[model samples]
Target chain A: MKKHRLLTALAVVALIGLLGVFNLTFDSYKLRILNLCGIYIILGLSMNLINGFTGLFSLGHAGFMAVGAYVSALLTMSPELKDTVFYAVPIHPFVKAMSAPFPIALLLGGIAAGIVGGVIAAPILRLKDDYLAIATLGFSEIIRVVATNLQSITNGPLGLKGIDRVVNTGWSWGLAILTVYFIKKLMDGSYGKAILAIREDEIAAEAMGVNLFRHKMYSFIIGAFFAGIGGGLLAHMLGTIDPLMFRFILTFNILLIVVLGGIGSITGTVISACVVTSMMEVLRFLEGKMDFGFFQIQGIPGMRMVVFSALLMIVILWYPRGLMGTKEFNWDYILQRKYLNIFNKKKKKKTVSEEN
Target chain B: MTILNVDNITMQFGGIKAVSDLKMEINEREIVGLIGPNGAGKTTAFNMITGVYKPTLGNVYFNDKNITGIKPHEITKLGIARTFQNIRLFKELSVLDNVLIANHLRLKSGIVASIVKTPNYKKEERHIYEKSLQLLEDVGLLDLINERADNLPYGKQRRLEIARALATEPKLLLLDEPAAGMNPQESLELMEFIREIRDKYEIAILMIEHHMQVIMGVCEKIYVLDYGITIAEGSPENIQNNPKVIEAYLGVD
Candidate 1:
């Protein structure tokens, strides 16, 4: 427990290091991208809990993120924007009367998204494999469609524009750290084992006394909650909102993060999220500038994704166990310095102790 | 009072009757064996008892309470644990985690207690891990505590499965062909292990084993099933000489 707290503290200090140690504008940009990556790490880890660990397929992450985004937006949006955004007086006449600070609004948004995820998961999580994947895809579309059609709230696709810019690099990084820390703690807990067992084998998990429905639902909703938080962070980062932002491709990007990181590995996911997010952001510099001699071709929109998907396919096909293969970054792996030292240490210790 | 009474339990899968009017009584701490040939409805009967399937024509009573069609996990929590014919350990998890998962059935922590990980929850979690480790020790698997379950050998995997089920702290344990794929030596060792577990733990065992030696040597009482029906019920000596049991086994051959 002391180790957990200490790690959390160090993570927070590292998060602050991005802003404190470097004062250059480049540092701000790096921090911004890193902050977004931090959110993605949280999002990716939650999805791993559901799809990777519980062996359930869900594509409704965007839906939960949308819920969090909208809930937080509604709570935090300046009164002037809300007046122009909503066609009807807010459903809660009294709630419409008041607005909160950005942090409170974001927290409320996370809680609301959690509730939404829980309710939806109760029914949608009942499905598995292709059925589950399809159901959750339908759920994401449902959320998207609702956000588009419901002009009374969510600004009906035009989205809440000129929104608050309180979600800077510092807040995003803090949340990312908190999210990963809590997830790691949970994974080490007993409930985490139940979820992992289900993924390894559901029928066996059930017979072993795991409440199959409950664990499946738990993973589904928790993953969704963090994805929702990530959405809130994204909204804050862009300082703008649009319905198109919550599209399937955005969901695909997070999935790519998990795939690159390795399924069921926390540390791997964090590193992958950081690497992928930065690479994508940096690759944006190449957009529409390449001029090939054969056809005068330029970098097209979504080109980076093509490369990313290609990389994802190769990684999955060539190394199905992933970069980390289901192993966590525990003290053993760290002390061993990636297993080399551990192997030698074990051999030396065994032989030396025997001789002694 | 009968702890578990199967009153003419019959199960049907479309046109086939998997188990038909199979009546049995399992009192506390009685090591009973259900022996039969392949597809002899022994697994079907065991499944019905463990609530894997709803019986076609009868009801099962536990502690004088009807538990004819409750969910499998609920039945486990009701003090009945089981092992499968095919070894079904959680392949990705460590052996300790395999046993710790079974402890989930007993954890009374609510969602809030878990997410925040309150003091009470930490205490409960630690206690459960200690208990899980103890169960591993009981099965002589403590040394391979951190090994992935799928990496264990055939015999050890079977033993680990038993240890996982035992972690549920069951009153009645249903073993589905506990000696199915073992060699003669492994099977004999298993027979002794089964007796030792039953006697040492004082837990009732209802095993569905095809090995005659296991039933004859260890089980105090025997039940035989063929074509989804209980054809014979007696002591090992009676089952050995019973013309009906021998004819059933020979006829199938």
Candidate 2:
């Protein structure tokens, strides 16, 4: 156990060193992608807590992100910028005067999203499965519509722009690490076990004294909190935001990462977030003109999506349970070389007779 | 020393009465049997006692406190726990995790404390882990602590379900069909297990079973229900001889 702890400390030090190297060496475009990867990691892990671990099919992450984005953007933007953006409709007096540091704005954004998540969850969580999915989906759309119509606060469809680019690698990765650490701690404890129980069997969980509503609320609210933080980071990074930026497709992208990574595995989420983010950039060539030695083909805008769909199909076909299924990336498996054995041999089953 | 008192509880759905005007009592550490033919509302009565269903009329009291219509988890917090008739174990979880989840109600630490790993939370977590291990040891599941619940044989799965209920530190345990699919020999062993748990845990037990051998072997008091009404309430021997119970089980010729 002591040795394990030592190894873990070393691993963390190595990770810090690697992050420092990437931050120093990477160009602006590469750095932006890396920051986006960190944000998505936060988003994917939070969504997995609700949909994958707690067994709630919540597709309302985009709504929570929009709340965070708007809250943080409004707070951090300069008063002059707000005035210029809200030319047609005057900005809310309270909101126009309010400004905070980037970090404070991010935290406030998370808290606001958490409050909204809790309020909606109180009524919507009473639903189950497909009904819950549809209700949450509807709620997300409602949030978007509200943001669009609330012209005084949100600057309507013109959106918020000229926001300060304050989010650096340190802020994004630091928050991502914190998110992973917090969720890991929660899941490794009794509370997490109770949440998993609710996912496995609600009737049994309730009978066993696991309060279904309370645990579900905890998961949903926490998930929304991190999603809000991710949104805050996104808005500040892009220096612009609008209601259209947080459409259903945004939630779908996070869901895609969670599903591809293995829904319940934190390790899977982190790895897939990085891979998918980079893959999006790498695949951008498909969306631009491709020059071959002999012939050139016209770029098909949105061709990246077709390739991604094909990739998703192939992954689902081969690994129906996702990349890691319900299993986490255990260091022991790698150390013992058991992962290689998994390909060579079928798992042995222990029958009742064998036990006897 | 009555631990559970049911006062004329009735459960009705539209025109049909699933259970009606049912009254029963269980004393401290008593092993009671609820036996009935299919669709006799035995499960519905269990649901009412455990707070899954609110009685249409009348009240359920645990330790003489009126607990009617309270949520199931609150009832559990009030020292009542139950096992489903269909064996609803958290199938993917380890046996130890299944029991630890049951111990979740007894945890004093809030979510923030647990997440932050406060000293109090760690101590409580350690205590629960040890208690879970001991509980598994008592139920003869210590050897299979790491095994997924669904991987257990049918008999062990039932035992795990009961162990999980016991881990709640419940004063009253409502088990729905503990010996549902057990063979005669397994049922005999289950009877011994039921008696042992009642003595060891010092908790009153109310079980619904069709296995007559197991019920008669373990139950000190028996209630017979037919079409949602109590037909007979007496000792096991008396219930065996009661013509109404016999008629309820095997139709009159």
Candidate 3:
């Protein structure tokens, strides 16, 4: 255990060092994609906590993200910028007066989302499976609609623009690391076991003295908190935001990452977040004009989505349990090759059983 | 010295009465049996006592406190733990984790304290881990602590469920149909196990079982129900001889 802790500490330091190198060496576009990777990791893990760990099929992430993005952007923007953005309708006095540093704005954004999550969870969490999913999806749409109609507060769908570009590689990756560490610690303790128990069997968990409502609320609120942080980072990264950006499609992208990664596996989410974010950039060619020897094809606006859909379909068909299933990347398996031994033993047992 | 008192409780599901006018009292460290044929509302009565179903009439008292219609987790915290008739173990979790989850209700550390890994929370976690290991050892499941709950054989799964309930540190343990699918040999062993736990933990036990031999062997007192009504309640020997009890199990000629 001591060795494992030491190795983990070293790994974290190495990751920070690598991030520093990328920040110094990478160009603007590459740095932007890297920052997106970190933000996606946070979003994916947060969703996993709700849908995967606590076994609540919530689809309200987009709503929480919108809350975070708008709150943080409104707080960090200069008064003159806000005036220009809210030209259609005057900005709310309270909202106009709010101005904080980037980090504080991000924190307030997370807290706001967390509060919203708690309020929504109280009535809807009694629902199970697809019903819960639908309820949360409806809530997300409701949030979007509210944001669109609440003219003074949200600029009436005009969306905020010219926001400060405060989230760089360091800010995004630092928060992502904090999220991963927090979730890991929460799961390693008794609270995590309670949450997993709810996922495995709710009635049994309740009988075992695990309060279902309270634990579900915990996972939901915490998930929303990190999702808010991710949204704040994205808002500052792009220096512009609109209500359209946080539609159902935004939730679907994060859900896609979580599902592709193995819903219950943190290590899987981290790897797939990086993979899917980078792949989105790499596949940009599919959206642009292409010329091959004798033929040229015009750019297709949404062709990349078709390819992603095909990829998701193939993955679902071939690996029904997703990339890592429910297993995490264990240091013991890497250091001691324990997985290989298990595989070999399984094979040997098969042979022995055949002889019998 | 009554540990549990069920005062004329009735469970009415719309028109049908699942359990009606049932009165039961269990003394401290007593081993009691609730026996009836299928659909006789044995499980329903257990549910009412455990707060899964609110009694349509009357009240349930534990340690002289009225505890009717409370939530299941709160009931467990109030020192009454129960295992389901279908053996509802947390199937995906390991045996040790199954027991550890039961200890969660008694854990003093709040979520923030646990996340921050305060020294107090760490100490509580370590203490619970050791206690769970000890409970598993006592139940003879120490060797299978890391094994998934569902991977265990039918008999061991039932035992694990009981072990999980015990981890709640309950003063009254209610077990529903513990010997449901066990063979005669397994049922005999379960009787010994039930008796052992009662004496070891110094807690009152109320169990529902179809196996007469196991019930008669372990229970000093027994309550027989038929069609949501108590037909007979007395000592095991007396219940075995009662014509009404025999009529409930075997139709009268």
Q: How do the residues B1-253 of candidate 3 rate in per-residue lDDT, one tens digit apiece?
A: 9989999999999999988999999999999999998999999998899888889999999999999989999999999999988778888788999999999999999998999999999999999999999999888899999998999999999989999999999999999989989999999999999989999999999999988898999998999999999999999989999999888888888
Residue A123 in model 1: lDDT: 82
What DockQ would you assign to candidate 2? Answer: 0.82
Could you give candidate 3's per-residue lDDT for residues A1-356 as a string of tens digits?
89999999999999999999999999999999999999999999999999999989999999999999989999998888888888999988898989999999999999999999999999999999999999999999999999999999988678888999988888999999999999999998889999999999998888888999999999999999888888999999999888899899999999999888998989989999999999999999999999997999999998888998998998899877679878887888797777788889999999999999
lDDT of 1 at A42: 73
As a TM-score, model 3 comes out at 0.96
Report the lDDT tens digits of candidate 2 across residue range B34-94. 9999999999999999999999999999888999999999999999999888889999999
Interface RMSD of each: 1.1, 0.8, 0.8
Winning model by DockQ = 2
Q: Tens digits of per-residue lDDT for model 2 on A286-319?
A: 9888899799989889998898889889889998
DockQ of each: 0.75, 0.82, 0.80
Q: Arrange candidates by lDDT, highest first: which order?
A: 3, 2, 1
lDDT of 1 by residue, A1-356 (tens): 57766865785677577555543555667767766776787788878777777778778888888888888777777676677666543434544566778887787777777888888888876677899888888888888899888776666767777667777666776787788878877777888888888888887788878888988777777887787787777777777777787888877888887778888888778888888998998878556667666666565898877778788888899878667777776654454585787788899999999999
How well does each candidate reproduce the native contacts, as fnat? Answer: 0.78, 0.94, 0.88
Model 1 bad stretches (over 4 Å): A1-15, A22-28, A85-95, A291-295, A338-356
Rank order (by TM-score, best first): 3, 2, 1
Write the candidate numbers in order of decreasing DockQ: 2, 3, 1
Clashing pairs in 1: A65-A228, B10-B56
Q: Is candidate 2 or candidate 3 better by DockQ?
A: 2
